[model samples]
Target: MSTDTRAAAPEVRISGIDPHWWRQAAVYQIYPRSFADADGNGIGDLQGIITRVPYLAQLGIDAVWLSPFYPSALADGGYDVDDYRDVDPKIGTLEEFDQMVAALHAEGIRVVVDIVPNHSSDRHEWFRQALAAEPGSPERERYIFRDGTGPEGAEPPTDWTSIFGGPAWTRVPDGQWYLHLFAPEQPDFNWANPEVRADFLKTLRFWSDRGVDGFRIDVAHALTKDLTDPLPSEAELDAIPRDAGQHPIWDRDEVHEIYAEWRRVFDSYDPPRTAVAEAWVERHRRPRYASAEGLGQAFEFDLLTQEFDAAAFKDVVVDSLSLAAESGSSSTWVLSNHDVVRHATRYGLPPLPETVGTTEQDRKQGAAWVLAGAPEDQLDREKGERRARAATLFELALPGSAYLYQGEELGLHEVGDIPDEARQDPTFFRSPGVDKGRDGCRVPLPWSSTGLTFGFGSSSAHLPQPQWFADYAVEAQERVDGSTLEMYRAALHLRRELQTDETLEWIETGRDDVLAFRRPGGWVTVTNFGEDDAALPSGEVLLASSPLVGGRLPGATTVWLRESQS
Candidate 1:
């Protein structure tokens, strides 16, 4: 660590003393089912994570964000929680979870667990009780239950569609319908109900008391809904301005009050537990979720959907920093997660239109090409890997926190060929041919180059792993110099040493395809997105994503430079 402590702003020093340690931390997301399997059960468990705590600490990440490990029905990939307070037996027991937390804490790493408050699994005790209860009862009031809108109550109450694809409302035996924003197995909670609010606060305190460091709130923005009689239709929602608190079922003002109450629970902790919202609201509404009085940080998801273009990358970076400054919170950068295609493979596909994911045609094409597997001839794998490397360097150099998904360190690509019979994502079943769902990115990671499932476990993995995964296995990449795994390790180690105050100054080169910026600590980062080489700034070369072209920065490359000692 550098002894020079002087800084212009509240610097993100890699020290345990900093209360706001997450500001510049690198968090690694570990999907429990795909990360590692310790019990030969073809599923990654808390015990497996315990065995790999040394690996996480060695990766130089400050925190590990574990996806939902709660008892679930496996609907929507664990987003449908059956219990808020216990670990799923298929993954591990509560004692094993505590052991995993202790192991991580012993290694100087923080533990952040996922909290799914928006909905619960249909098998959840409360949901089951609600199902058995009669209409207009207090149990039913805990969820969004309404009478049908048509003759003989035969139609859905609203025109809203489930995110997994289908009607959001599911009719029960009592001739009443309940709302589920995701799959039918996951019912949305009635946030207006005091029981829902009180229960979530208890969940927060439960994990915090167990020494959990932070939380990743699933579906953070869509919790509170304005269930006015004669609810707004899809067309009516489209006509409404995209402002906070205006929409009927999304980004309403009441959502913030929930977060406000949760923030109080967070503050009650010793160092004050932190949280990040997985909200997909517009950039303008993002700050509301990220406010210090709320969830503390909101995921900047625009970067994940963007093409590997210099101009587009720069725009999102600038916009995120500005928003973070206004909100008095740090911004988050994540390229890939369990929900989307891995960037390593995504960058290889053809560029999407400017308004990506906004149109039905674009989304359908994306699912077909990116998720359903485009022909091998259409993909430029080598090019995509190179861009992926450059993008990681660019993202790590930015001001705030960075999130790395599991298997990304080894440069893993999407496993798009999982047989339909083995597919488990609800999106696949719900949407049929329209969407392939997210199982491609959630495949078990390859730890070694040998074995039937690339050493994922004693038995085959729950999701099949391509044989080519052997090439990018952690064991193989560890030995190869300049591999993606090594590059990530070096970047993370260097980031702590070279980082300065939370400041980003644009370095103008008068080139549209080049993006150059300097931090206050004489550290400079340059990324070239054109077909031509670009000149490097005057500084000592610290690291490069790829080899330089005759000492010039090559296209689709990123380089880190530091002020040379005279």
Candidate 2:
């Protein structure tokens, strides 16, 4: 018989883990628009992403989730799908997709496409026909329709609010209303229709057969929206007594059933795969998505969850991990993604002024965070690096998968501020000042110290790449051993010690500021939030983002530790 160490080896292994990895995966979300720009169409594209795959491979994540590349009208930043089969002209072509998949596979990195099946762009063929067809006809029923749907006059199916801000309903010219939990241009899908299910299943097969490894389904819980009379707000719907949305015909159970079938189908493909859900529902309902045995991984917004003070931190920690364990599920812990501001800026790291700045590309150098003596003029060289490292450590230590957004490894923070004129996000036109939406996080990635507009683009970048990024680009960090780039390498090297193939073994102790758990092969992780140290009883320091283990951590002031099994 094999020894304990050999027996602990996973049956499946990818990059030293399971063949169907992503279990303890450190997934990196790439918002293509913000990642890297290769063609210089004043926008990012597949070539840019391909050039950067090695950078990701070095970061230690098993897979990369590329947010929608399908043809879109740019509604909700590509969340509105116009065509299910092709890449957006704004990005690249089918050949580029093939090349990118090959490059990533060469590096042993799996690729997951963000699928927006819960809704479709109004320009979609089905939606166009639905608009031309009479209400309740086969085409019309492809979307959720009601003769009288709305809150008061502007109400949605429920009291639920839009995350981008405003009521969730749009009045169609037909005098009836259509449900849109997000934007008016995006129409909700009618999961009750078997045809819709078949079409989406084909969508899954379309890409999976074409070499795509897996899917990261968007707004998964929202796909199972309650069609009940109470028409509740999104949160209340989860608490509205399960049987309310449950019928032989509508809601969540069917959604789970769809995923199970999809999972089975993926298993039959060239490379067996898994599904990760963006179950962005209220706290109480997230469990249902993973509880059904349909999805392989689900995401939790808690790492992005913010508040000051230790007790408050404890509550978040306890609740976040508890929910995952309660349902026998594992979660992907995300701090910042394409949808939110970078954690460096989210934690309030201000922009470095231009004075101390280094080169033409290094406009904001050495603008590091300190308690006092704020400067009015531009900096000589700012240092936000420590704070950046702190956030990275916190994310890596938490139980389950750790999702690091692209550019984060380089300690990339929010842009220095782009004018409203250059801003391309719909949130600017739609909500204005009420919410910055996620523009701060979607700035074009910086590639070099030479400043070719965006670091990689030949012409002016499609999006504003931070001037600070060039000197701080991946290439620049690669040369310096102590750079943020190195911190990521060290962190990943340490993280590998924690098995990626095994099912995560989690123990929910108390505390929100502190998240404590043990790995499947007997490694313990203790992560502390700001204001209090995530105290581990005993163990050697396996990995840390900060120079200090107990006090202030690296960049974000976060800590990650591994103790002895005893």
Candidate 3:
């Protein structure tokens, strides 16, 4: 396994167990626009997040991963960044950002900011300059600008499809088509340009100098595209085995060299800032992104896509651990994030057929279901919450980092009936309503149940919140016994003590619907996925996702036990 050569931060008192705290840290993700709003402008801001630092501290997370707070027009929910070096005025000024970081640090919670190197807003200064500059100019070279293929340049340069469901190329006023893998307003950067490389290096140092702990690299795999003279057709690209080699626009071999250079910058600091890649590469190739010489960790997202099956979850954990071992780094466990359906809602949905091969496709299917306005009658909220709680405990017991999205602790479900006009995700408009997009999960959080917007802000929330959100609000859950929020607090508090090291050994139960694993320090975690309760191994009960009946773990429940010394 690869080792971190940099010295650990002695001043950091947050989980002094590992010099690289990220390895076992329970990091919470904050989608800024939906987290909290202090300005009472009906939007979440940096000041709003600063106000919630205590809430996070009590949540027992070691770190907070903030989604893009950079300047943006909300073209793509802040992913379409307009500036890399400054904060958006709508949220708060850079000073407020510094204050937010300080507040988090005071609570011993490290901060990880988002870095979108894959693309920039069409309104970004560089893109603006490129639009005004002559063809083949250095300004144009910073992005992928090319001549169209058909007569009078009417057709796009390639038959590439945007991930949002349209032509990937957009024709400029000058008749040249620019490449955008996602939205037309978000143009892909030409990583081959030295200016692009140097600018990102500068952006890294800027944040690192500001005392930010790390970065979450967005769309991390597509930074370096193989821009050959003759690009491969979509059909040709699809036929190639994913593991065979590099593709033209995703997971190219050259991407590692850029990361190696970035590693040097990451290691330059005394304690050395860290980063995790949101890479969606194949399992075998994923280790490269997690390599010690490159990005330190790769998000093991298969867990997020899973349907809470014992065998499937076990397989994911085993493969994730193996990949982390190969990369000499720790895996990251996440059940939900800003880009997908909440696990509480997902657990209630029917499992994808065996024919579905990828997590991306699985997520797309989930989104399509939501867009189709599937009736709430189909959702088993009781079963979903039970399975969600069990899954959270199962994820926490694993031998790696754990990431929790905002509002998950309260067992929030996706709001499927969001009014069409209120929808903001580019996916909805780009897909032309074929996909409802991520607005359901991005709805502003409900802090209290008394107000119309559930105390999100003084005014209405940007997206309409369902009245049922009051049932899951923090205020309501805190007052109730055995609520999802209370259970999460209990589980997280126990996790810090029970999670000892990066080691997990399967304890065969000789049953198909059960999963049992032993961690270091004699800490054991068991989950019952069968239709009926299952007998537990002999151990002292430390924590349980639900109340144990006759010392048995109920179906769709997980428990943690400590083996007593003889």
Candidate 4:
């Protein structure tokens, strides 16, 4: 799908994929805070993202998931919204956003943004009005209102903790109690109210009309809270976004009705829009089983948990596919996103840099091994290589859609240094040591090597581009054939070539280390996770880490093979 072809399509609906195109699509998640910064404001913005669209297109991704950019106080890294309709002045103007959208569409790449419906910035007029006790205000009803009279005007209802690791209830500047599941600045919306659902629909329409294809809906499960049943009823929802076990105490029945209504709204449009839920539903739950009738997709969070073991991983995959999908119902993927630590970091890579202190080629070989096998010590350099390779291959090999974090392909490690003064994420400030906060992993992308800015420009990139990663800047990697950037490009381009058509369907070839699957057009992706050449039984290996015998894989590599067409 190229820009010229997409633009020339006959239907005014902007066609290509059924609303579910994202299922087969490989989506790259960008923390705008860490993407390229065009204006050197030491922060990432819509313009900055515009500058990097080509970078993503070249990366061979079908779509990009951007974190929220609504007008905000920058609390919770733009998740707390002051105004849903306008772009944050710090990020860029709405006009720039329009151009970015058109530019993305022109490039044949769809744009999906993070829409936070669960809560809004307390600074928003609605919250302010509520705080002022405005007469007959609709805003007051939008958020949950408890009179503290349940069990004899005493005993605060439930004792669930806020996601930032504090009491979920915050005393409003007014004399009442307001709820903030994440940040004090953010007040959770009362989904129990119809007006909340209606306003949310309006918010969706605003962006869709502005050219956004859809949204990734953040803290999606939290939209529906069990304020009555001791705060929540599920282990997963109780775990918070950063923690594991995302069962849905908050993912309830009415959500299906809301999704169904939204789907009807989408049908009103020509091409039809896509809507993805962030929480998981039971195998027989309405959102997962009856999803086709209402929403386009429901996110599967099994990957975000401690279910990193191979068998557990496989179970999640099988379960996800079996659940919402009968034949063509949409199935979502969850490997990595902005809120979680980069996969490269999570799979137990050394907390610090591994490839350093050695020659680039030597480091490449070491990384290959690390990516291929689980580590004796997750932080060991010997294992980082195999794990990196395996993780990358596995993500690409998944049946449903996939998400790539900004620095993962670069084999980037989690940033360890956080100057106390510079740590902006409320999670750290609010939780203390219970959570280190997401600041390090979400810092600005360094594009230059001259110094700290990673070659993105200067120290003034949109959000403090890390000085450490700056040395591994994009240009530096582009110049080096074996750099992380090139590897990512190769892997991505290879995936594009393998999945030439729409869907990715494959059979498990009965091997743990060797993950073999077939693409829609009879092409198979066979991966070998070892230090020596691994053989493929049926087809000739097309792509390899090092030149393979049958283009076979030696030294932890993935080979694309296509059986002859009948």
Candidate 5:
């Protein structure tokens, strides 16, 4: 096959075709604290992101999902939002946020900010008022403040445990207890209060009016809780059943009502702004969050949680597509994010069990084992990189939208050895030696091989980068052919031109270790997960994650092929 023939795949312009571009667009997630820092403050800021708009535009992503930069005490990594209407001074001012949004718009990239509607920072004015007000006061109605049960009101209101490993209820100085599903610094809102619902709608409009495109709702499933019900014991909380019906705090049916109201607000806009829920509900219940009246999209996290196996990947993709079809919405795909270990290192770990149990102890033990085993010296870097590239090709070739984390394109591994003293993740202190937390995946990105902070900024990054990051620096990889960064750029460029808005069709290769699928445009993607090389289908190779061996797809590799017309 000639190079010209391989490069002759059809090209389609996807930008201006439909107002609902998010249905098929690829979105890049930017963790502002580690993405870039312009003012030499050692923390990434809005200006730093503005400086990189060109980089994102060239990468071919349709939108940028900015994690929470709201004013906060830095508890829970900005998820404890004190002010929803403004940006944190450490990140940038509101004026800088508007400027950044305008710059991103100029580059044809949409901006999706994170919204933490389920909780507010304890420092928030409302929470402060609630703390100062007497019991049963109106000011206390904004949050979930309950009277304790035991003598002298010393006992907690319930037996619920926090997601971060402590009691969910915190006793106030006034003999009352308050609910905080996450950290104590983040107080759960009383959604039953009309004021809370009205305020969130106002916040949504505030950003949308300023040209924000959408929102990636934080804890989308936990906003509405059944406070009337008794709290489950620690064991029951840990083993919360994954069913469609209501639970004490998660995936309650009332949560959809909040989204439905938000959807109406989205529809009120000129372009109909979009939203994606970060809901970890049962598969059957997940579709409800993306129904026609609900948010238009929700993160399908099965792909992120699955083992690096052909069968597992195939199952998640098919199931997600089916769910999207049923819900009259689009599927969203992601492999890595700020909250989890980087997929490159994760792929290097041993195969995981098919079904993880519901017990908290079981889950914690499993996670600890994975984290403890992922030391840099213990990982198979070569094999991991091969699989990571193959996985990227496989994910981007799928039908629906894809999400790329900050450093995945560089094939960066988790920084497993972050110093104990420098660690900042709440999970680290909350779990204390049992789990390492998510700082490994949140390290600052490397833009240059030689710099104070690898070109992330003039000052050292807040989170330390491993010495080996120089090998994956953007400047170094841009010059090396077949580098991971270049591979991502090429895959994204081709995805825009050759991808179709069609469902995937599996092509049987009679091999359990291989996944082969054909898209609408005579384009076929094949991934080999076996020990031996697999025979390639008869087609012109448009792209490959790794070099093919004797016209055979090598193990831990993927290839995009265009069926020959003649």
Candidate 6:
């Protein structure tokens, strides 16, 4: 490993440590339940992940971010954590987790685990104790418990609604209501409580001491709430203003203190651990989460939400890079994750609305409409695949860290045909039949063309796999040249040599459809998002998302070019 440490801003570096590993590294997210299954129990586990470490190393990702594998009741897909220090019995034992970490280190891949600090599983011991204890007790004080309004306390304490659906406040037998922003199984933690803060710090040290590289802090912005202020109406919550740190429940100024202390904990380690906040705040407010004394990075989600237009992509990228530079933190780019629709299917649809509908009802309706209309026949699958490949190349070529969700390298599309009975996301259940939820993107990945579960395991998967998945299986794609899998491998391998710059220089491509930019080392990348072919710059072809049309870049394709010597 190179020991040369270059001076960067405090938010981007840790004293003498070299922070380049995470700054430009390509990290792969493994949603353990759907990644691979080893025990034939129809669920993916830590053992399954250990079995696949070599595969991840082969894919060339510098690190792997494993989603929550903690003990939980599976409510809200394990975000409700019953235990922070131990692994879920279904996943594996603590001993197995240590072994997996060692194995991944041996393969030169770091491990980042999910940490859900905003809420604990309703089944968590503290929550259980709160349930049995009287209101106003220390156990109950750990959570956001408040007295209900109206006669006999019939009304909830506030008008807030759960992000999943229904009222955010759940009334207990004692007539006091507890706040749960997500599913009722997840009771929001009261960060005001000293115990809650201390416990989470302990959880952080437990993992870091065990060799975990970092944490993807779930609901990082929602940890601190302003109870003194009136709860925002459902409408206000729906259309949250971009104003910085003024919201009652979402992104508040107090959240930084928690992260500042966490940063100190990370800095104490021999090789300081890192953290990336899964904060959904506005672009302006996101920097605070990654400020000098806070977390190292925050997810820059503009690319994930933007349309496929070149102008729009350029604007988002430029804005994100600018914001990160201001905070002295590297921007974290991600296309898709367990929460949203897969970009492959998203790109296939007609141009998305500039803003998703304001109300939850409208948003769900719009999502259902898109999913229903996005069949292979209605969508240009060939065009979608091309654009997806091009988008991946564009994202990886940028001068910052990039995240790849599992199976995206294989070009998997959203499984829109998943049976209603098989849907597991809490949003789907909370909303009844109104929304289909995110199970479409969480379906078990296909590893082989022929198997009981496509080599996911010997038994059937927890979620049904569609027959069409056979075509995109790793076995088939590995054998084909110019496949999406190969494109990803080659692009990742080449990215290491090219992504040495921390800044991006936009090259005027003249055409609105062509987005062009230059990185360090005379490397340039161009993506043609228009309907017609775009002229390529004079250079040697380093890589192309698709074959060029008569030596010209075709629409919906991206190419990496190295400036040639005269």
Compute each candidate's TM-score over C-alphas: 0.95, 0.78, 0.96, 0.82, 0.94, 0.94
The parts of candidate 3 lying over 4 Å away from their true place are 1-18, 359-362, 370-374
> How do these models rank on lDDT, best leading?
3, 1, 5, 6, 2, 4
- Candidate 4 — worst ten consecutive residues by lDDT sum? 1-10
Clashing pairs in 5: none
What is the Å distance of residue 559 in model 2 from its true position?
A: 6.1
**Regions of candidate 6 where Cα sits further than 4 Å from its true position:** 1-17, 229-242, 354-369, 372-377
Model 6, span 312-391: residue lDDT tens: 89988989899889888898888888877788887887865545742334444556656754454666667778889999
C-alpha lDDT of residue 7 in model 6? 20
Measured by lDDT, the strongest candidate is: 3
Instruction: Estimate every model's Cα lDDT from 0 to 1.
Output: 0.85, 0.65, 0.87, 0.63, 0.85, 0.85
Between candidates 3 and 4, the TM-score winner: 3
What TM-score does candidate 6 reach?
0.94
Q: Which wins on lDDT, candidate 1 or candidate 2?
A: 1
Scored against the true structure, residue 181 in model 3 reaches a CA lDDT of 93
TM-score of 3: 0.96
Model 4 ranges off by over 4 Å: 1-20, 134-138, 149-156, 226-249, 280-290, 304-310, 350-378, 461-467, 500-512, 529-533, 545-556, 564-566
lDDT (tens digit, per residue) of candidate 4 on 202-248: 77776777777767766555566555544442353444442222333
| Candidate whose TM-score is highest | 3
Superposed Cα deviation of residue 88, candidate 2 (Å): 1.3
Q: How would you encode candidate 2's per-residue C-alpha lDDT over 308-384 as one tens digit per residue?
A: 23454445656867887766666667766876556665455444343432221121112122111233233213334
lDDT of 5: 0.85
RMSD of each: 6.1, 9.7, 4.1, 7.9, 7.4, 5.4
Error of 1 at 78 (Å): 0.5
What is candidate 5's lDDT per residue for 1-566, written digit by digit as tens?
00111121122222463567888888999999999999999999999999988889888888899999988888788888988887789989877887888788777788889999999999998999898999998889999988887798799977877888788999999789999989999999999899899988988888887878889999888888777746566677657675855777788888888888999999997688899998877788888888869988888878877777889898889899999999989889898888877889878877545455323344444455567744556678788888989999999999888988999999999888889998988878888887888888899999999978999999989999988999999999985789998889989989989876758899999899999999988999999987799999999999999999898999999999998887
